[model samples]
Target: MHASDTVDEQLELAADLPPWEKLASKARALKVMEEANKIIEDFPTWEYWVFFLLFMTEFFLAVYVSINLLK
Candidate 1:
């Protein structure tokens, strides 16, 4: 809640972390990207598109109702 408490917590966290360069190393970055791609590849893309189309339909219907009511 206080500034000093926040600074102390951040300092403790910084002490616990590895160096920034090691965290952002090239091999690590590539491995992280590969894992991320695998996760994304496993997603159900058709379900996403189905929800998108449903949302658009509802949105347009709401807009049409509002316009007719205003007129």
Candidate 2:
């Protein structure tokens, strides 16, 4: 809530973390990306349906705005 409390918490956090380069290994990074790609490639049709609905909403919104501005 107060400034001093925020500063103290941040200092405590900074003291505990390792340097960025030492965090995750190159092999671990590759493994994570490979797993993510597999998940994306295997998506079901139902998920595509959701994406279609979201896109249709945006398309309709654009059409509505264009018509109103022309008026």
Per-model TM-score, in order, reads 0.41, 0.38
Question: Clashes in each model (backbone N, CA, C under 3 Å)?
Answer: 0, 0
Error of 1 at 27 (Å): 11
Superposed Cα deviation of residue 12, candidate 1 (Å): 52
* Tens-digit lDDT string for candidate 1 (20-51): 74344434545655677788899879989999
After superposition, the stretches of candidate 1 with alpha carbons farther than 4 Å from their true spots are 1-44
Best model number under lDDT: 1
User: Residue 29 in model 1: shift from native, Å?
Assistant: 16
Q: Model 2, residue 28: what's the lDDT? A: 43
Query: lDDT tens string, model 2, 1-71?
Result: 22223333444555555665324333345556667778878877787899999999999999999999999
lDDT of 2: 0.62
